[model samples]
Target chain A: MADWDWDFTWEILPRLLAATVNTLLAAGIGYIIAMFLGLAFALAQRTPSNTLTMAVREAVEFIRSTPLVLQIFFVFYVGPEFGVVLSPWVAGMIAIGLHYAAYLSEVYRGGLENVPQGQWEAATSLNLSTARTYFRIIIPQALPPSIAGMGNYLVGIFKDTPVLSVIGVAELMQTANSIGSENYRYLEPYTMVGIIFLLISLPSAALLRSFDAWVRRKLGMN
Target chain B: MSYFEFLVAHGDLLLSGTLVTAMLAAVSIALAIVLALTAGLMRLAPAGPVRWVATVYIEFFRGTSLLVQLYWIFFVLPLFGLSLDKFTAGFIGVGMNLGAYGAELVRGAILSVPKGQWEAALAINMSPLTRMRRIILPQALVIMLPPWGNLLIELLKGTALVSLISVADLTFQAKQINATTFMSAKAFGTALIIYYVMARFIITPLMRWLERSMARKLGRA
Candidate 1:
């Protein structure tokens, strides 16, 4: 068995921890963008005009079907060609956010579908405006069931932050890669990154599960 | 160069890369299914130690990022006098990662098989191994196939990550062409379309067929 070197792990612990902050920030901002944009896309698909709805649906499907890493490379590399230069950080966030938005839109669509038809009829009978009906009747009920799905993706995006390393985002994975390349010892660095991810994901997963259970109970679901 | 001219010139390279990507995804998923089935069954084992081992394997692999795992297997293991080729390492890393996820699906499907079925198998005096092999596993396979198909598509997309470790898959080939021609649009654009076609034309149809066949078999029974 190979004896792990504790001194090396201890020395690099702070650096990994520091990079983890960037990872968390990226996940936070990306998730926020995804949440809002996902709603926009989902709403766009349900727009009154058939042409607008079809175009939006196709665009979302295309984005959803492609690999996120390739999307990141495309946005990061192609943006400058189109006279829209973005830094690696911005590019990474946009790519991750857009990719996840396509997914979250589906979640939102499912949540919206779960809203019973009678609720909309009741809102109509009350002479509510379309916007008011959506805000007061539909969205309030649709949002909660989708919370668990959204939370899962939050953890997913957190886990996928390492992919941003391909664009040199200086997140935990990038930091580990550079450290390994410089020192020629990947054991400590990669293992440290794995530990850091477990530290975050395992706890978040447990919390999400409990939250899911609590939500189910609140909804009177078994 | 025009996008058309660039694509025409580099068409052969892109095609070969696409072929490699498909082959890698197919092979890795085949291996992953076998691993997942075994580990997943072990997860439901009556023995406490067996279940613990399976849980540890799944959590440890699923919790970490695939990129880190790929780098470790491809780059780090050699330091400890255990070395694998780049292609082997890529396959192992992706297979293990997907296996961790697939195992959960397998376990869920198995458990979803009604308790009455288990009781029936036991009442018939079937051995535990025979019951699983003849009854539980067959039903679980049908239930597991649809989700496994989705995971297979995910695995296909994931193979692009192998390029980072020098596997020369589709993404790597596109990067190579882009570097030489500086036609990022054509190179990457072609790669993306190829992936889309594979997923839409091939994987999706195959999954539908599997779902139909499984449904038919269940109905016949």
Candidate 2:
């Protein structure tokens, strides 16, 4: 154990910190894309047209069933083959966004299911339009329970940002791999990478838990 | 090469890779179930220290990324003069990581088994071990299988990471074939289809069947 080298750790600390920013950027962009795309997919599924809903559901399921790394590689490599060139960052965002959108769509579906049927009926009785009923009565109540699951996926997407490294996105894990390859000291780089993940994930998990609790209380489930 | 020609040439390699992936996922899930049960039960232990130890183990594993953990186990541990085979390292890493997630599901399922059942077992003058073995465990297993099935699918996806550590799984084979042939469309498209078939046709249906059987046994259906 004494073979562990502190000097190497110190040397790579700055590089890892810089790469940490890239990881955060990837997670933030992926989350924003997933958040909106998920809502879109959910709404698409709820659309009145049967053909559109089936197509959307099948697309979401296909994305959900496949591995994210494979999806990342597919988008990164295959897109260029089709004459649709994308930088690694853009490809990674699209893959992660599409992948998580499938999951978030399920969350939204559950949230929508939990919205009391009477609420829709009551809105209809008040002669509200379909759009007004959704915006005023349905979405407001349906969103909170889904927040916990959505937050979990946010942390999940954060953890999974390492896969972006495969496409040369220069994230924290990629930085660690590069540092380890350059210095031949795997301990510091990988351990530091793990620590960076723990530092970010643990706090975010706690915050999500509290937010979940607050949402529950607001819904009068407390 | 055209996609059709590429598929014909590399068909056997892709098949073997898919088999390797399925085998790895099966082995990892098996190991994960055992580890999850042990850790989950420990987490519910009456003794504070035992519970604390389990909690810390689960948290530490769950808090970090699986790739880092895999690299640490595969690359760093050997530096400490304890070398592991590539397959063992991959299996253990996947098992340990999924076990952390599975432990939570196991704990929740066990707790969901109903308080009165435990009291009823005690009232029958059964030994605590027998009570758990004969009554609690079987019911918990039924409840746990559905979530465990989902975790199993996650493990299947995770097996792809083993390729990074030189495990020669499906993703690795695709990458190799792609590098040689530059037929990314054929290689990855086939790989994606294979994954879809496994997850959709096999695993998802199996999980639904398990859930249905459990609900039937519990008379809840």
Candidate 3:
């Protein structure tokens, strides 16, 4: 059996912690992109134009059905051929951000659907512009219900950050792989990565669930 | 060379890759269902430690990254004198991960079976075990199906990660073909289409059919 070395784990701890910062940053930026892009996708699907609705629906289905890793590979490798050379960081952000956007769009759609039909009618009767109706009235109502799903994806995107390591983004998983190769001990680095992920994921998931409940209560949606 | 020419050369490689992906998905999903049922039952047990064990298993798997879990089994387990072949590792890793999520779905479905049904089962002098097997599970299976369809699709997408472990799955073949011909678009693009077709055309319809049949069994159709 391979022995676990305490000394080796301690030596690698600092580097792994540093790489954790990169992981958090990637998840943050990717979430921001997903939030906005997903909103745009959700709104696009609701437009009066049948063509726009159908196109957006098909696009969302395609993205949701495929794997994120393949999408990352496609953008990173295939982009150069079409005269678009991006750094691994930018490429990873775009690919992951877009992939999650498709999922978040569905969540947004569910939230949007939950808002009663009368709310829209009430907005129109009050002479509010369509934009105002959505932003000031309907979106606020939709958001409380959306928070739980949004939180799940937040954790999901963070967990998926390691996949970015495949394209060489120097995240936790890549760092662990390098450390293992250098020290000829896979046990320490890999185990360390799992514990770190568990530590971050479990607490964040709990926090998000509470936050979701809190948002619903504050909005009188409970 | 053009993308079409690249496809022409690598078509057989892509097809074989598709086959591996299908096989991997089939194996993992079957294993996940069994684990889900066992864990789901444990979660509802009256004993405290048994319930706690189920909770820990579900949360632990659900909380961590599947990639790390897969790598841990593939890399670390071997160091500990339990070296699994790639297929076995992939099966255990993905199956266990999906099992955690599926257990929750199973629990939810079981709980959704109305309370009066349990009372009625008790009145008929049925044992708790018989009530679950005969009365509760039949209804829960239909209720469990729609979400299970989504989980099954997620499982299919997850199988792509097995390629990272050198499983010669569809994603691996795409990479191999790309390496040989440097036709990144054709290689990855073909793989994408094949995946889309499988999810959209085959797996999805099959799940829907299963769901409908299960619903009919409960006389809900």
DockQ of candidates 1 onward, in order?
0.67, 0.76, 0.86
Each model's TM-score? 0.96, 0.97, 0.98
Span of ten consecutive residues with least summed lDDT in model 2 chain A:
A1-10
- Native-referenced DockQ of model 1: 0.67
Better of 2 and 3 by TM-score: 3
Ranking of candidates on DockQ, top first: 3, 2, 1
C-alpha DockQ for predicted model 2: 0.76
Off by over 4 Å in 1: A1-3
List, residue by residue over B1-221, the lDDT tens digit for candidate 2: 67778878998889889988999988898989888989999998999999998898799889988888999999889988878998899989999999999999989988999899999999999998898888898789888887787788888899888988988888989989988887788889899889888988999999899888877987878
- Model 3 C-alpha lDDT per residue in residues B114-200, reported as the tens digit of each score: 999999999999999999999999999989988898888888888999888999999999999888877888889889989999999
Top candidate by lDDT: 3
Summarize candidate 2's per-residue lDDT along A1-222 as a digit string, tens digits: 637688878888999999999999999999899989999999999988999999999998888878899999999999878899999999999999889988999999999989998998999999999999999899989998788898889999999999888899999999998898888788888888999999999999999999999989988976
* lDDT for residue B176 in candidate 3, whole number 0-100: 91
lDDT by residue for model 1 (A1-222), tens: 355889988988899899999999999999999999999999998888999989988778777767888889888888776788889999999999998998899899999989999999999999999999999999989988998888889898998899999999999999999888887778889888888899899999889989988998998877
Q: What would the per-residue lDDT of candidate 3 be over residues A1-222, giving only the tens digit for each residue?
A: 898899988999999999999999999999999999999999999999999999999999999999889999999999898988989999999999999999999999999999999999999999999999999999988988898999999999999998998899999999999998997889999999999999999999999999988877787765
The residue-by-residue lDDT of candidate 1 on B183-215, one tens digit each, is 667778888888888877899899989888887
For model 2, give the interface RMSD: 1.2
Which candidate comes out best when scored by TM-score? 3
